[model samples]
Target: MSQPGPGSNHAPPAARTSPESGPPFSEAGGIPVDAATPVTTFSPVVLEVPGRPVDLRMKVSAPATGDNLPVILFSHGHGPSNFVSSLHGYGPVVDFWAAHGFVVIQPTHLDAMMLGLREADDPDAPAYARSRVEDMRHVLDHLDQVEAAVPGLAGRLDRSRIAAVGHSMGGHTVGVLAGQSTADPADGSDLDLSDDRVKAAVLLAAPGHGEDLAPAVAEHYPALKATAFHGMTTPALVVVGDKDWNAHFSQRRDWHCDAYSRSPGPKSLLTLFGAEHGLGGISSYDAKETTDENPERVAALRALVWAYLRSALYPGDRAWADATAALAAMATPVGAVESK
Candidate 1:
């Protein structure tokens, strides 16, 4: 994979000191904030999947200048949200990854609340979880066209270094791509949707196994009963909030860490001190969904995830090492990292 070479021209503007004066900025892990590459975004890059009812629309963001840039396929979480589930959400993480030398492609899944489609509307609606995985696969299959749709991004992506990231239900979406297996709830047959193309993954506040789910979850999201992670062999980092207790999902908040504990080796877990499902407002700048709206926390999360991605993709990069060390060295650490 091509790494960021030394050049001041790619640097983003210095972060402002006054909180009220400008947008909040977080320090980049391993790389100096001013030394990271600038970003450019192209939105609503539409692609059609044969036999699908709706065209897949995506938002692509990349460094303003660079070649062989790594790709991050981000899946937006399902919510009663309108625009967030579309190509318009998660600006915070998407922009950060792009500005720091990644090509982030975010696709709106069919389960998006914005679509206002109901399970009773179609046979596939009951298989929304599976569709999320297929949406990502479609994105990979049409990477050439997606890149072509965005000027200056064409021919600049490193296809070998792709990572899948998701939040909430989106987490389950990327989990499947990362090797987690599930059974079709309707037929009780194994559903192996893993994609080898995704070299790494990050699951944020993802759901746990079905057997351990809270009673409410089993009653409502019955499809989760088939979730299984024993096959999630890809290198991944699972980030969960210490306070992200979803009474409707699991009896215990730590249940969210199943993706880390149950997955095979070469995995890491990040336990954020006071974070919730939103993980310090990663979904948006100031969306009401963020119960813990700490910019500092969001910054740390971004840096740590970026560092892990850097190390996992490049092999020789010590970004993860430096980032973990930085976190450990903090006088009052915001989180803890453990790997096996």
Candidate 2:
């Protein structure tokens, strides 16, 4: 089952739904919404991949009524595309930056790649890895076209200021885009360094950190390999929940301490104190259990993430002063114990 390429006939999803547009995750039960901005969404145009029929999902947003602005591309973790865009659809983050003044695009890669078609008949087969990267490339190209059509989007997108954000498998895509390898095992052989379009990356709860990918992943794509995040030239901010299954692994440790230390530009690691692997934003976490145990910890986790995103995206912007202050203002919850 081949997918529609970069300029196919698929229609983009309707924009401006709710504040929680990225992934559906609640910290302490109830419902979660963005505390930062008004949810004004923009429509996306469906395009086909050049040489293939894949349909890539992309939404563009600039300041509601401003000129050009920095562009950020958001890629969701691996799984169904719906899983990524359900509630906190990355749209909220895009909307946040747009509200503060920036153009953002979040692409639906996994959905377009796999389309729920199992290739090897094995439920766990790695059917969409190849298609995933291709879709990423296609999305970038599509965005270029989009910028061209909308004159206002042209110069506004600071090519050198572009950044990529990812979680789980999407983080691996960012690593690949950053020139980190996914083939040579000990070396970064599978890296796609040709683009040079991305300026920075934010990898959240990356599943691509282990020595070898998980068994299900390994079985699906035996050629899959990855190396240390050593050669990244641009600044980066790696965020991980301390309780992530691999939080204590050597790869995770090296990525933070060594990778950040050796990188040419500035870099930092932020470990969310009590958040689980999926963080507090995805559905997989047991929010009921967490809330029953501790509530302040949950709020702290969200605040830390929002602050990191603010400072990283806008660097020296004065408006982010509040976010920076919030970062420092964070304190340990009354009864929660901090862990390394």
Candidate 3:
């Protein structure tokens, strides 16, 4: 479909209740909540990239009414499940961001099980690590097209305030875009896919450098062996579960914090107590994969992420400070935030 032109008069979605009125602030850090702005979502917004076998499709969600909205390009994790790895996944995070006034764009990468593409079928599939970074760049290149797809969303985006967020394998994608380095599996050369446009990043349950990978992990995912976070200088918030231990990946449960530890300063880590890789079901709502299905945990995560993004993107915003203080003040906090 052709991109929508400027000056189009598109109707906005209806209004809804603000988040503050719907729930108590005790569970989530007592950050003052704003009146909920309604959200409008557009799906299957297709864009074709040169040399790609399949067309790129994404879902765009934004507040029903807002100006100068920031953009968040969310990359879904690689998984055997077809549904979670597509544009249809991560409603919990995407919806919350949209309702809170950020325009979130999610692209279904080649690795998605829905496409049925395999490395054996094509040597260079979208499922590969490098392609994931390219996919995010393509989304940024077509921001105008994305804005055009959503009614009344034209010229409302704050292109300068962009952020990249991802989960698990998807977190690796964010790390690469935020200046992490890796060696191309095809040719043992260094690969740098960082994009300066990404002002900030969020990596959730992301794997660390491949050097520490266990024998089983190294054999199954050889590409991760070349993954390095030394160049991930961008400001980022790394979230991990204290109990998220994987025998296949590493012997240490704290291995997931490598992104925050290995990366340079201006980074923050949030360790969720008794949480697992699912991180309180951020991937989907009530999915069987969620070992930690506490709604309060999800709520806390959502609030913390939103506050971190707001504070990072907007220098004057103290949402992060207030939220962190509230968390510290809690007699029994769900998690802790540490920055370096």
Off by over 4 Å in 2: 1-40, 80-88, 110-114, 118-127, 142-144, 148-156, 184-189, 208-216, 221-224, 246-265, 282-325, 333-340
lDDT by residue for model 3 (185-262), tens: 677588888999999999988887777877755655556777777789999999998877775677666678889999
Clashes per model (N, Cα, C within 3 A): 0, 25, 1
Ranked by TM-score, the better of candidates 2 and 3 is 3
List TM-score per model, in order: 0.89, 0.66, 0.89
List ranges where model 1 is wrong by over 4 Å: 1-25, 28-34, 123-127
Query: What lDDT score goes with residue 249 in model 2?
Result: 29
Tens-digit per-residue lDDT, 199-263, candidate 2: 66766655443343445434344434344455665556666555444322223433323334444
User: Per-residue lDDT for 39 in model 3?
Assistant: 95
Pairs of residues at least 3 apart in sequence or in different chains that clash in candidate 3: 18-36
Q: What is the lDDT of residue 171 in candidate 3?
A: 90
Highest-scoring model, lDDT: 3
lDDT of 2 at 228: 46
Each model's lDDT: 0.79, 0.48, 0.80
**Candidate 1 lDDT by residue in tens digits, 251-272:** 6656888999888978999999
